[model samples]
Target: MAASPELEGTESPAPRGPRELRLYGLNAVHAAFAKRPEAIRKLYLVQSRIPALQPLLAWCVAHRVGYRVVEEADLEKLSGSAHHEGVVADVLRAEPESLSTWLRDLPAGPQLAIWLDGVGNPHNLGAILRSAAHFGVAAVLLPKHSSLALSGAAARVAEGGAEHVPMVRLGRTDNALAQLRGAGFALAATVVAGGRDVFAADLPTRLVYVMGAEGEGMDRELARACDLQLSIPGTGAVESLNVAAATAVLLAAWRSRRPG
Candidate 1:
């Protein structure tokens, strides 16, 4: 939630837009620029990164966007993270879309999505976004009460995956389920145990994988409501794989069965 580095007196006023976010890391900044170049309000980078970011620099000069060449330590201090990767940008945060809007605009196909029941870790969310982008996931469904939102660390960890995936806000649980069912999507609850093996199960064409939190797991009522319960087979080595890793595995399984 930290804002980007403030420009000195030399810079002009930032353009009005959505909430601003400080995005460090080369790939994260690059992705934001590639997706919405106009959203970039200000930029700060070490001299060494200039060559790789020549296009962006050219855009900044043409548009009169504020940019500064500072020392590595200055970037570290400004971004409040050592992983700035010699570049940082102030960009407008992409807002989440309502369920109705997303559903209305979604194209019909063998689409895939994930419903985050209680997954809250930013790193896990980033990893899930990365996997979701890799597997062509349509949207990330967030529950009504969920507090999850895109953050600087999550974007950095996603390695540009965040730009490709849209976070969608769900309505009432039952209503959301009804809408998805009407859209020809099957809900599959991913449980730690007592479920059909993912590798052997007959996956649906339009499927939404419901993932729960780490310790408390999915809500009992929600899990029971799903059309199918799925579990990844493991040797009971250490309870289960992390939620992000499990998501990647489940998505891969689905894609393998229905390759495009």
Candidate 2:
């Protein structure tokens, strides 16, 4: 069946999962409050630590966000561990945007997007999202299969990037690539061998840089779909750069070339 553009950027309702909002560590909680305070529904702090949390408490109070000073054990229970560092916040999950919506929303200027073929690691995914936000990429595309969702770990690692960049989960990587190609995007896949150096490639403004999983690299179907496959040159001593590191390097290179 021919793929319809209807499903391009649509997101189904968030799946029902854990009830309480789970956020651990002081830094993570602080990041949410500072970057995306509207996501915070309630702030939980240990009674004895309220003094230490005075600044955060004041912000919550001023924002009219709910807060409760509970026992240490209660905070731990709420966060699912004792590593919360005496603070926990009930925050809404970051919403995922449709790929089509992101593409349409692109301003009348240069546009770039990153597509992950089969990334399963939350940290790597999060790091790439952070890089995309930093480089002003239009959006991030992930294959529905074998792709990690935007979890708390991803959000924490992104340091608020997850909230800024739109993330679209595709039903199939190959199909999504086809759609992107139809929309005038040049597909450039990062491969270990048999590809030009990324720096030498004629990466255009509307390019989709594809990065595959760490162990498997780009699959045959994905590699074949690429208008060009590129590699980040490295010393023979190391096999290749990690996906996240490669993403940063590729994004930086692309951004540097854009007309400023």
Candidate 3:
């Protein structure tokens, strides 16, 4: 193991935040630094990764941010996962903006977003975020009571997409529904069956796709409150597509109609 590189300027790592995350994977760490270099608290990586991370290391040295070249085992221990992919970073969690604040700042135009009702799995969330970013989703809306939050594994799975998409906090269901409607967004509740075919449905320009949980599905009342419901027609080989897969398909369907 190489000796930890000493930072020349700063006295120590930035004060640890209440919810700091240990982000891993080359893409995840690189994206985090690209988006917010100031938020990086510390970095750890294997010796072989140094060459590929010259720019990041240079930034660390310039900003007086501490970094260490450790063994692969050390990287795994630091990240709490074997899939750290040669690098790990401790970064402050980016807090989600409140619904009102997001609404206030949103530009008037065609947009798309997803409302994650009960999809709490970190990997699933990561996949959804990755697709959302690929399709230029406006944001991911989280209900006030949802326990869904970004995690290290999620960031790794997202492969940099997490940095591109914003998460919004919605306080109450009724208020959130009304707010979205007032903003000219038509909510489309995605269901497994008994809904319009996604490929054929007239998707709105400003739309919110309500994604349910994997097993129990979305709340019946919430589905009823939506402007319309949509389903993906599939052969009866399986019950339905996984929530993450379904989300990607929905976003793709929406994107297909809005060719610029």
**Model 3: per-residue Cα lDDT over 105-196, one tens digit each:** 99999999999999989999999999998999999999999989998889999999999999999988999999999999999999999999
Count clashing residue pairs per candidate.
0, 2, 0
TM-score, per-candidate, Cα-based: 0.92, 0.78, 0.94
The lDDT for every candidate, in the order shown, is 0.88, 0.74, 0.91
CA displacement after TM-score superposition, residue 187 of candidate 1 (Å): 0.6
Off by over 4 Å in 2: 1-21, 24-31, 34-36, 45-59, 62-64, 69-87
- Candidate 3: residue 95 lDDT (0-100): 96
Task: Flag clash pairs in model 1.
Answer: none
Please give the range of 10 consecutive residues that has the lowest summed lDDT in model 3: 6-15
Candidate 3's TM-score reads 0.94
Q: Taking the tens digit of each residue's C-alpha lDDT, what string does model 1 give over 77-134?
A: 6566778899878888888898889889999889999999999998899899989999
Cα-based RMSD of candidate 2 = 10.0
Q: Candidates 1 and 2: which is better by TM-score?
A: 1
Local distance difference test, candidate 1: 0.88
Distance (Å) between predicted and true CA of 18, model 2? 4.6
Best by TM-score: 3
Models ranked on TM-score: 3, 1, 2
Write down the worst ten-residue block by lDDT for model 1: 7-16
TM-score of 1: 0.92
